[model samples]
Target: METWKEPQTIILWIIIVALFVIILLTSIIFLVRTIFKKIIKAKEKEAAIQLDYQKNLLETTIKTQEIERHRIAADIHDGLIGKLTALKMQQEITSKDQKTIDALHESITVARRISHDLSPPLVEFTKLPELIKELLDPWEQHLLITTIFDIRAEINDTEEFKVQITRLIQEIITNTIKHAEATQMYLHLKQTENYMALYISDNGKGYDVAKNSKGLGTKNIETRVQFLKGVYKVKSKIGKGTSNMFLFKN
Candidate 1:
């Protein structure tokens, strides 16, 4: 009976040890699962935050663009137009002699050219490539600028995208000459995979875009890209030059 009692005690101790091991393993597994859930929750929260930030940024950018467009329109209508009207009034008041009239007429022609250059009919009539070439003509000799025009000949046949693309190219080229200090620039237009890509790269002193103010230049490019339903990428680093790449899908 004592021997039987001793074996029973040993069996009970073995059972207790096995139960403790099982309990320890279960606790460890639960802890690991809880840690994994916490990690997942944190990642989800971060993603949500990033999405919200992007949405807000896009909204603010749209508002800023509208304001700028209004300002530019006002400048064209009220400012430049007013100046031209004043000039015409002066001409009317002056003598009607042939020499005087001829000089006035030439003056008027120059004024008209300036006005047209500032706010061109290309915005409504000409194709994008032609407009870009027209804008770059003055700077060509000064900057040693060379163009690789890959613009589709039939692109202007469609009214929808032509105007927007022209505006985008004008802004890009203007900025490249004024700010990039680039000696040579390249413009490439191509279509692939149901998308059109415009690549403009310049060899110049690059800028720190992240730290720089995202002013009218950057905003204008961004707005044009958005209006065209395109993706835009600007890449630049100090001493390495800059590239503005735009991809549009039809």
Candidate 2:
């Protein structure tokens, strides 16, 4: 009986030790998991804050640029263009050189064009389709541009929105002319009750979007798209062509 009791006691002690070890390991694992989760959450929070700061900085910089552009346009229209006009008038009256008058007239036209490009006047009051036509008419001399407009809903028509849209389109056109060795361009605008869409494509020598580094023009397009809370996608192939599609809330 004594031998049996000793064996039973030994078996009980073994079981107790096993239970203690299991509990200890479980507690350690739980603590480690908790620490890891806390670290992850902290990192995520920091990333979000940093992103907001960068976005705000970008917004401020863009607004400042627009303000400066407006100021410069005003100066060109009110000061330089005015002076050019007066000079042209004086030349017409005093100079017999038709060539001189023609040159002065040309200078005034160039100044006016620059001023208009810098800041379009009464943009908010203009219908978007009309404004786009006015913007693209001058470029017709450079490339074959085809446009299609389908409107079924009222647009925001705010000055800021229109200006951003205009700038975005301008940037895309400038990039195509400078880089794409293509001749024809297409623009299609569509609007519904819920959203507006813009499609622009060029029959130019397209580059691989993944391989090429984005230039300042691309960055500016991204910034303006973000400002408008719009989404855009670009597709291009080496020898095919490039196309950009943008969608915005109406």
Candidate 3:
């Protein structure tokens, strides 16, 4: 009864230990992969939430801007323009100097122009395409630049749509002047039965879009496009040119 040792029993015990170790490692690997997948999903959700927040912020900001512009336009009409008109009238009646009267008149006209520009002309009577044309065409007289608006389809626009579209085009032109320094710009619009396409391009000196993506103008464009539920593609590089193409499915 005291002589029960066997080599086969020792080998069997070794095999069982090896199997246990292999099983443990497999379980650990499986657990690690599961944890990694969860982490990735959590990160993706966080990113989506952040993007939503940013979009909301952008909408609020644009609305606030419109209010401020309206307020400023009222001030110009009721305050500054009023005073300037009164001064001009007094000069015309009392002053013998034609030059002084002319100067006051010019000041009044300039103030009115500024107010009109601040509040984009998205009037009830004006269509969006016409408004865009008016907005871009005037720059040719003031700047050393040429702008072309090629409209392939007539677009019926609501006031709200006109406001956002007007702002987007305004910001794009401002950016072109500030960054592109190009002398030529073109805006193309095409509307089909189901979708609409817009293209804006500049022949100016371009910047690295990757590095300049956070600019206010770019952000404004992006926010408006998102509001429109549209998709955009931008191509830009240094010393080359910049182009933005937008597509909207109705």
Candidate 4:
């Protein structure tokens, strides 16, 4: 009877020790998991703050650039162009040399074009489609451009917003002309009450987006898209073509 009682006591002690070990391990695992989760959350929060800071910095820089552009445009239009116009008139009145007159006229035209490029006029009053059409006219001499506008509602946004969108389109066009080496381009603008969409494509020699996305032109497009609080996607395959789609919530 004494031997049997000793064995039962040893078995009970072993069971108690096993239970204690299991509980200790579980608590340790739970504590470790909690610590890991907290660390992850803290890292995510820091990353978010850094992202916000970068965005704000970018916004401020772009705004400064726009202001400088406006100032330069004003100076060109109000000072240089004005002086050029006066010179052209003087040349026209004082001289009959056709070549000289033609030269002055060309200079004035070039200056006016530069001024227009720097800052578009009457952006607030002009409809978006018309503004885009004007921007494409000069490029039409270089490439075949087809535009389809399905504007169901007016984009009564601010002048600054319109300017940014216009600049975004301009950057795309410039990139296509400079890099794509394509002959034809397409633009489709659609706007509704809820959103506005822009689709641009080119028949130019396409590139691997993953490789060239870091290019300055692409970066400019991305910055403008972010500034507008819009989303964009690019699809490109070498030797095929490239297309970009931009959507802005209204």
- Against the reference, the lDDT scores of all candidates come to 0.71, 0.88, 0.79, 0.90
Which candidate number maximizes TM-score?
2
Weakest lDDT window of 10 consecutive positions for candidate 4: 1-10
Query: TM-score of predicted model 4?
Result: 0.88
Q: Best candidate per lDDT, number?
A: 4
For 35-124, candidate 1 gives per-residue lDDT tens digits of 999999999999999977876776576557545654665575567656656665676677545665566566655555454454555465
Q: Which lDDT tens digits does candidate 3 get at residues 1-250? A: 2332577776787889999999999999999999999999999999999999988987788788889998999899889999988888887788657998888888887787778667865476797667777777656663454444454566666676777777787888888877678887778877765777778888888888788889877877888888878898899877878998888886
Query: Which candidate, 1 or 4, would have the higher TM-score against the true structure?
Result: 4
72 Cα displacement, candidate 2 (Å):
1.1
Is candidate 1 or 2 superior in lDDT?
A: 2
Model 4, stretches more than 4 Å misplaced?
A: 1-15
How many residue pairs clash in each candidate at the backbone level? 0, 0, 1, 0
- lDDT computed for candidate 2: 0.88
TM-score of each model, in listed order: 0.58, 0.89, 0.71, 0.88
Q: In order, what is each prediction's RMSD in angstroms?
A: 5.7, 2.3, 4.4, 2.4
TM-score between model 2 and native: 0.89
